[model samples]
Target: MILETGVVVAVESDGLWVETIQKSACEVCVAEKGCGQKFLSKLAGKTVSIRVLRNKRSSEEFTVGQSVTIGIPEDIIVMASLLVYLLPIFTAIGGAWLFSDSDWQAVGGAFGGLLLGGLLVNLHSVRKRDDVRFNPVLMEEQIQPNILNFQH
Candidate 1:
């Protein structure tokens, strides 16, 4: 599980609205210095919020303006990216090589494989869109006041 912190901006009977704080490392990477991402993050000022899963345990209760930390599975992100972008191209190349006959059959196989791969990738992504996990946690001593203004 990967842990990330956010501030609770709103409270509901079932869950809370946690505004995720965007960190500088997201844009400071040397490889992304000149990319469109840097410009976009700058324009947005680094915070986004959506409802989080309700805690089943009573100890996890959260109130408005409270700070919380959520645990998200890292594997989900990795698998999703791979499925969407790599699967199609890989299937196309592999199918083409395996079915090659110096004729149009090779072309047909390659196109079919690529199409199937892309379709599967998109379907998987949509199915797992709600898999993000959230939990409420107390802020550490020094950072409570700053979570709301840490945006850059």
Candidate 2:
């Protein structure tokens, strides 16, 4: 399971809105000097708000501004990466192989397959948007410590 820390922003009937910053892993990665993830993450906008189900925590205790740790299964992340990255490449290769009789035909087929793959990805996303398996779960909550006042 992968964990992320976020702050509870609001309490709703169905879930709690937890807000998190878009932090890049490149900072601590050994390949930071050679990788483009840091640049891409910078271009990607910050401040993501996720709706965490209330099944794990109660509104009475999980108040706004309280820090919470959420977790997503590693398998989910791996599957998503494959679907997003490998699907299109495989589809294009298949199309090219199918139309290998002529160079022009193969090129056209590859482009068509890429488009089809992208459409499939979009359809899958729409269909699975509300899937509970894709949603992150609240693992732990942290309440801020109260400050002590000194006697005058």
Candidate 3:
């Protein structure tokens, strides 16, 4: 399981809104010889909030400003990454190769295949929208020191 610690910002009947501070090694890497990832990380936002679906089996919880752990299965993440990121790329290459008789045809085929891949992704998401396997599950209540994590 990939676990993340976040503070509950809001609570709803069916879910909780958790806020997390996004951090990366790039933000703290002071090595002068390092790449430009530090600059990129600075350009990106620092705080993110995500809604976590509540588990019915979970006991009644606390109020806002409380920290909690959320987790998702590693296999689900791997499969989702492949489907969301690689499917279009592979399909586009295949379409171009299959229509390689002419340059224009190949380009058109690639674009068409990309669109088809996107549609397939959309369909899959809709079909599995209600599946609990794809959603992040709320783990145990986390009570730790109130140490603020600011890497700015």
Candidate 4:
């Protein structure tokens, strides 16, 4: 995951609004010290507002203008929870039933099954998202082009 720094622009009940700095890639091809794109970005500001998840330990490091590194996508939290809790619990029950001889043996079987399932699931998820990793995207502005320019 790409860890990014942004400024807190707004605070919502469940999340936070952050204006992240997006460096212009135009700099890569620019010949001069500064290009028109850079100038425009600077003029318009190199920031994009993005909504981020909030938690109880809400770090006070971020202020309206202060910079902070917030995690993007935020789905890892959910995925981890599923793997940690649901996977284990489900595996335990299933494993116990599959290898049921006594109560203690069933309990041990359940834990073992959960371990295998959790590991396999996590590995699969990691491989799946390897190319398209999770990241926060900014809201796009809608623009209408001049459609009157038609050649007959």
lDDT of 2: 0.76
- Stretches of candidate 2 off by over 4 Å are 7-19, 32-67, 140-152
Task: Give me the runs in candidate 3 sitting further than 4 Å from their true place.
Answer: 9-13, 24-45, 57-65, 141-152
lDDT digits (tens) for residues 1-152 of candidate 2 = 87778888898866789887756355578988788767766777467898776545467766677777777788988998999998888889888889889999999989988988898888988787657687677775434422332225
Q: What is the lDDT of residue 81 in candidate 4?
A: 61
In candidate 2, clashing pairs total: 0
User: Which candidate number would show the highest lDDT if scored against the true structure?
Assistant: 2
Query: What is the TM-score of each predicted model, taking all chains together?
Result: 0.49, 0.64, 0.69, 0.37
Tens digits of per-residue lDDT for model 4, 85-125: 78767877889998899988997898898887788777866
Q: Assess each prediction's global lDDT (C-alpha) against the native.
A: 0.64, 0.76, 0.74, 0.60
Could you tell which candidate, 1 or 2, scores higher by lDDT? 2
Q: Model 1, 60: alpha-carbon shift in Å? A: 15
lDDT of 1 at 4: 65
lDDT per residue, candidate 1, 16-51, as tens digits? 678886664564578676666666767886787856
TM-score of 1: 0.49
List residue ranges in candidate 4 displaced over 4 A: 1-71, 74-76, 133-152
